[model samples]
Target chain A: MNVGIVIVSHSPLVAEGTAQMVRQMVGEEVRLAWCGGDPDGGLGTSVQAIIDAMESVWSDAGVAVLVDLGGAESNSEMAMEVIGEPRSARIRICNAPIVEGAVMAATEAAGGSSLATVVATAEELSPL
Target chain B: MSKTMTRLTSEDMKALIGAMQAAIAENAERLTALDQAIGDGDHGINMKRGFDAIAADADAICDKPTPQALSAAGMKLVMSVGGASGPLFGTLFMTLGKSLPEDFECGAFADAFAKAVDAVAARGKSSAGQKTMLDVLYPVSDALAAGKSVGEVAAVAAEAAEATVPMEAKRGRASFLGERSIGHMDPGSCSCSLLVNTIAAWISAKEHAA
Candidate 1:
């Protein structure tokens, strides 16, 4: 199954950094999306930019969205809502420790697992 | 919020791992709610993911000595998780992991915890008034540093966390909102409170078990 990963944060640097880090583990198989950042050229205009990116990479397999802090989660939820009915169900939003989740997700993606499998793998890293 | 408690054993730390996992999972909605209020709304979700990874690895994590286990977990958080808070929180754990001596004793946990908080402050580039997790964590760490009881520290931490509601966001994502973020409680601060609270309970349990 195809797996997609999205990283959302107030700082684009954090998102970019996470995606880059994940790439080292999972290679090019993971779909990467960054939520909010300074609008410069085609990077993204609003949260919707992230949503659009998500849509482009999405398939029936679903996507996992990882967010940085408070509002990013809310915005992702809103984006899921606004992304309409079809794509929302496939998306799983994980609030675990960012680094751990990325590692788990990356590993599972490399293994060619479903969204549920990857989500389960990520949860195993929970702090308690 | 300073309350010094006993040192945690392997079992105690495992329990905390479980509690933290459950807290993040059960309160995912609340975390999202808090984030939605002032910031990105994924604080709960992101934290929950991080915790899940930690908890799932609990057996292997607890198998090691206290500090090593904590450090390993911290590294996982820093490398695996994404976001400023990820590295910040990860740094806190990593500091704790390092500060903990191989032959750790009850008396040293508080000092190590305080050091961990200092690391968080450094990583987040925040001080108390800036109204980030530092606002909540500082009071707790200060209490711990001052040799307060664990219960005492948790109480103060909870209070400080609640007090953050009126403060403006001065760092990270919420900072972008300026005045808009003032009335809402900082999500990172809130999560830190939960973490401190859970840690306190874990120590208490360990003490009783001993």
Candidate 2:
């Protein structure tokens, strides 16, 4: 399996929209998932939701996460801690825009790139 | 009175935590007012939500060692607070937990607090002189490292938060206002000072009681 790509954003629609872009860009070549919004569907990020997304897209090739804003990134970081150990070490949070990063990471992973390469490819898109 | 706790101890930590949480809950409107002018007007609600979660586990968190309790509270905040604030404030408490002794001591506490300030800056991707929480945090860290009393530190936090006024924003949602962010107090700074004052009041009262 290729490195997985997960999209995180403060808005649920934004997360799903970004995932749509990634899927359109790379099709079924790379595993993918997306999550956003708080438990109550508020304008915030949820650690639980992020962890669930990460788990859904987990692969030995590792996972790459792209976030739209600060809370999204931080909650994803907390999710990493919760994931812990072997899986956590494999995951990387890309410092790029959620939509662009997810697409680029998915495209690279579809080529069977490693986690680090996929992250670097996505982060190379734009600095956020 | 639940308005304030008069002592701090193993048992007192629960009451002190309650007081701290109450401090945020009680001032939620004031904080919301401040944010309404410059930010998204959710700082008060966000902070209260996090502190309320902390209150739910006050007994359990306080039962742990001081460092562990701080760390636990930090984790709680990250999961509950949300926004950029979740990680920023979370870094502050978590770093303190990592850097402090099992028991709290002023000298080590000062050093640890300084570390926490640095961690906050790193996590927020901003630094002092920005209209962010780092403005208050930096001076408070300095005051602590200089051996200022808890009361004095509290005062510093209050003053530092006020100091944000008239300064153009350099970071966070408030920064989008440009010069318009100059008048209102930064919501994050306000909440940080509120928390500092609550903790300090209880500690100082306990010292006087002894």
Candidate 3:
């Protein structure tokens, strides 16, 4: 499997919109999933929803999670805890702008970059 | 004074949840207003959603041991609340739940709370004076370590929360505001102080009842 990308945002629209941009950038074959909004459909990220997204796009080549805000990062961590093991080790939470990071990371993953390369590629965007 | 109730009971946990729910409900608007100054302006709404989940599950949570109850509450928050505070606060309670002993004493409770606070710091990659929830939680953890009463700890936490009003946010969305963040209270710190205050009030009421 190729590297996967997960976008976590507090707004469902933001997550979906970012994923749309990433899809346009990376094209098909780069598995991508997005989680946003609370269980009640309000603005907030959900741990279970994030975990579900990660699982949906699970890749043996590893996964990179880009979070939009504070709660998203923390919730993603909680999801990682639930995911556990070698798979958890394979996943990384990149500290990058969600929209740009998703685009860059998805492109890198599409190029079959290593998980670390994907994460580094996203983090490098921090200075931009 | 009678000996302090060391170990928290299920009843105490229920009371704490009740108090927290009430506090969050009361402060939601103020929290949102604070966030409007430097953040996305949803801290209060997100917190209310999280606490509402906890309140909904209060009966189930109160059926567990104190540690498990707290952990469960944290899980609910993590699942229900969004934004930075959700995970940070969720980890705080979850870590406290996981670290405390089954029959914990006050000192052990303090230790567990400190550990939870540390987890929050690590999770946020932040520390005191960062204009985040840590601004309130760190000092409150210290007061707890110093063996302060719950009321005194609440006072210290409130002061720390107030101290954030003058700070330029260094982390999270508020950091995006740069120097503009100064003069606005951090929404997370405000919420944290409310939680601490509610816990203090619950403990006081419990003591009075006993």
Which sections of candidate 3 miss by over 4 Å? B1-5
Which one wins on lDDT? 3
Better of 1 and 2 by DockQ: 2
Worst 10 residues of 2 chain A by lDDT: A36-45
How good is model 2 by TM-score? Answer: 0.90
Residue A16, candidate 2: C-alpha displacement in angstroms: 1.9
Q: Summarize candidate 1's per-residue lDDT along B61-163 as a digit string, tens digits.
A: 9988888999878755543344445566777888989998766544576678778888777666578877788888778767766777778888998999899
Per model, how much of the real contact set is kept?
Answer: 0.02, 0.49, 0.86
Instruction: Please write out the lDDT profile of model 2 over residues B33-145, one tens digit for every residue.
Output: 99889887777888888889888988889888878888999989888886768778888999998998775557778889999999888877798888999989989898888
| Residues A1-128 of candidate 3: C-alpha lDDT, one tens digit per residue | 67899999988999999999987777977899998897778887788899999999997888999997677887898899889997999999998999999999999999989999999999998975
Model 3 Cα RMSD, Å?
2.0
Ranking by TM-score: 3, 2, 1
Which candidate should be chosen as best, given DockQ against the real structure?
A: 3
Q: How much is B120 displaced in model 3, in angstroms? A: 0.7
Quality of model 2 by C-alpha lDDT:
0.84
List interface RMSDs for the candidates, in order: 10.3, 1.7, 1.5
After superposition, candidate 1 runs with Cα above 4 Å error: A1-128, B1-8, B206-210
True contacts kept of 2: 0.49
